[model samples]
Target: MSLEGLNMLWQLVAAVFAGLGAAGVGLILRQLSGKRLPRWIVPALGGLGMIGYQIHYEYAWFDYKQAQLPASAEVVSTETDRMFWRPWTYIVPLTTGFTVLDQSNLVTQEAGEDRLVEFILYRFERQHTDMVSHQTYLLNCDAREMVPLSGDNREPRYAELRHVEGSTPLFQAVCPNA
Candidate 1:
């Protein structure tokens, strides 16, 4: 299992505990209300709260990661959608998939004066179970650029890379030896 898998596992465990805690709260509320609440109401409310919290966490995951990630991290790709079940998502889009690259983990090479950098790409998909895809790439970081290498069937899609601010970290981190 990868770090992301471990993170999701921990979230699942926390959700269960949160559900139970909500049930406990319901019990306390029932007691405070002189048991006017029906026996099933407490369990029902707990279940709803648990599911709501899990949904909220999953929906907020992209924003959470963006906030927590290092400044050197770059969002290479992203997709969003309006989930019908979550009406609020109609106004605010939800990330269904994304790819992020960390500048710190790159290898460098030089073709004469031109610089070439190799690095890994981490792709994430949100679904029934969150999934991660890993690939590698070799980028030529001169005024004109090309991806000389990449893992799997994937090739680099972004051609106007040199103009992006994120490319600064990428070039700096990858071209230190050059």
Candidate 2:
């Protein structure tokens, strides 16, 4: 199984345990009150606990993954969204994904007036199953342009080439002197 599969399985297991613990607390409360509390309170509390755990996990996932990255990885950008289904996000947007640039993998080349830097960009997204994807890119420091490179020959995809702003973290990280 993939790491994402294992993580999902662990989440399910943890949610079940949370429900069970909350139900146990409800039972204790009932007992302490001489059974005056309604029996429905036990299941209600269990459901609440399961939902609470899921919400906490979703909100904390970004920070948890960020902490696990190596020092060489720099977060270039983050994606946040507010979905209608996730109404709480309207109050505070949820971080659904992020892009990272690995400084350790950067390869710089100087040819006359042009300074070219090659690096890999890693993208991580949260979904039903967490997804991670990477692509190699070539950047021109002087022109502030970036293009994705193809396999083996490192052919640049001019169709996808785009100008990068100097103020962006990606540009700043790759072309510090520029």
lDDT of 2 by residue, 1-178 (tens): 9887898899999999999999999999999999999999899999989988988999998999899999999999999999998788999899999999999999999978999999999999998988899999999999999999998999999999999999999999999999
Query: Considering every candidate listed, which one attains the maximal lDDT?
Result: 2
Candidate 1, 128-165: lDDT as tens digits: 67778876767666643445344366566566333423
lDDT of 1: 0.72
Most accurate candidate by TM-score: 2
lDDT of 2 at 105: 98
The number of clashing residue pairs in each candidate reads 0, 0
lDDT for model 2, on a 0 to 1 scale?
Answer: 0.95
What's the lDDT for all of these models? 0.72, 0.95
